[model samples]
Target: MKHLADLLLLGDPRLYQSCEPVLESELPLVPDWVADLHNVMEEIRAMYQFGRGIAAPQLGIMKRLIYLNVDRPQVIINPELTAVSDEQDELWDDCMSFPNLLVRVRRHRSLTLRFRDELWRPQTWDVTDWGLSELIQHEYDHLNGVLCTMRAVDAQSFRWRPTPTH
Candidate 1:
């Protein structure tokens, strides 16, 4: 199999649409997706140097899925973020899916998402803070043909990318 980055992440209209349904009956084992996902994570890790979490859909997987974990970096999550605080916060965000651009996004301050573990057992988690929340929301948006820049919610407000600071 090719490296995950070899997979395209942009200019695909699918990345801009709702992800395909993920059947709960066949949730993948952690070993199944994690290794590939980890490779993708490592490939883009530098883009997220000060950031946390990334998702496959942003890499253009049209599945009801994502991977998320904060600064801890010990895990790769899928079908992530089932329960998010109805309460959301707005914050500035950068994305591996969208490099060099910073956009303001709205997300729950906390969440409880469900997914299978490495062995494929159903599980849930509570998450808070900007990284996890923002990442989940960002990736989730990809599932809906949406991008973080869309958070600006105005075509005019969207910028191609940011001017990097030295």
Candidate 2:
């Protein structure tokens, strides 16, 4: 029963490594992991005042799964970015794995993604909102072994932007 306390911290080697797809046989674990993600995300959001999404790898589970709380709790499994606009925008992105830091990064302004829902149903999302677009990209990076730190424009692009409570 992995909990909020078991998050793979910033320096954890696993956080820098790629993740494997969630196998059909492993689908049973999805609910538990999703629960953990939601629980931890809630805590982080309340503590920091922001945090709309999280990835499975953040919890040390190398699976292609991500959770988002846009209008509702959304579970994206085996997500694939089908299309990305050439247009981009810069934002100071933050992550649960490294809560104290913010990385200046550029992300697409719109995207089309294909993924499976919590019930294993195929779904497609055409995101146009810059905020959701960037959020998806951030979580997608985690699925592919990339982090905001790696996406930082430069060394100076990374900075300490700890939450007020911190």
Candidate 3:
């Protein structure tokens, strides 16, 4: 589709520079933008086809936006982690930013997030377990211009193991 082709992929020269945070209250949450996000979510979901979360930056949107399908379609702006999980873990997460590339990233096993709801209401929720917590962390990283790959502590920490042959 011509529309899909317009969305630049990683390393594409036209991918716009990300903008600074647009305060939570400033987001266009009406059905137009929100509904469009649903379409974007579908494309992003299908784009990865086998991944967890995808951020707006990965989709070439400069806004501080995130869309995930774990519990609900969590749309967050200016998201910040108020509290990290009591437990911590090193997780191997793959990103659509780099297809088929996986890297270990440290994340709180749980979190209490201070973010706006879909309606732009300031709310707090305790994200338990990996699904919601990991989703939140992944999206939050994008807002901060940090991708999953950069989380790897060092070059040695990431290894691409090809198929073993006899």
Candidate 4:
């Protein structure tokens, strides 16, 4: 039952540390972790109106786990990216960790994700859509201690998120 407050914010040292893989013996712990990730991500979506996925490190879990709920809920554990396309797309990327900032970064247009599920079953997803590709890559980077800010296109690739006027 984690909340938005439990999310690790930008500048937190733990957020920059590479995560460890979830062990088979730790499968029992994944449900609770996924719940926390889901709760926090939902809160981010409600407050900021944007969030497709989140990684375990974002909550200080220090594991290679990702919870994504676009059209449905998906649990990705120990994910590895493969078959990444050379084609790239540049976009303004936002993160729950730094809700008030955006980074312009280039990402591969497509990639294949291979990971284990909550039940420890191996799974693979071929992501080709630009939006989904970007989202997956963003979350994947979190597991490797890479942030969008670290991938910025240039010195001028950073900007404050525009506040909404009600």
Candidate RMSDs in Å, in order, are 3.6, 1.5, 4.5, 0.9
Error of 2 at 149 (Å): 0.8
RMSD score of candidate 3 (Å): 4.5
The residue pairs found clashing in candidate 1 are 16-145, 17-145, 30-118, 81-113, 82-113, 83-112
The better-scoring model by lDDT among 1 and 3 is 3
Instruction: Score residue 91 of candidate 2 by CA lDDT.
Output: 92
The residue ranges of model 3 lying beyond 4 angstroms of the native Cα positions read: 1-8, 11-19, 23-25, 29-37, 159-166
Output the worst ten-in-a-row residue range by lDDT, candidate 4.
157-166
Task: State the displacement of the C-alpha of residue 3, model 2, in Å, after optimal TM-score superposition.
Answer: 2.8
lDDT, ranked from best to worst: 4, 2, 3, 1
RMSD of 2: 1.5
Model 2 alpha-carbon miss at residue 104, Å: 0.5
User: Candidate 1's error at 78, in angstroms?
Assistant: 6.2
Ranking by TM-score: 4, 2, 3, 1
Question: Model 4: per-residue lDDT, tens digit, 1-166?
Answer: 9999999999999989999999999999999999999999989888888899999999999999999999999999999997899999999999999998999999999999999998899999999999999999999999999999999999999999888554
Residue 157's lDDT within candidate 1 is 48
Q: Please give the range of 10 consecutive residues that has the lowest summed lDDT in model 2.
A: 157-166
Q: For candidate 2, write residues 1-166 as lDDT tens digits.
A: 6666888888889888888998878889899999999888888877777789999999988899999998899999999999999999999999888888899999999999999998888999999999999999999999888988888987789888854954
Q: Which candidate ranks first by TM-score, i.e. highest?
A: 4
* Alpha carbon lDDT at 144, candidate 2: 85
Residues 98-158, candidate 3, lDDT per residue (tens digit)? 5556787787789987766667788787888776687688778776667666678567666
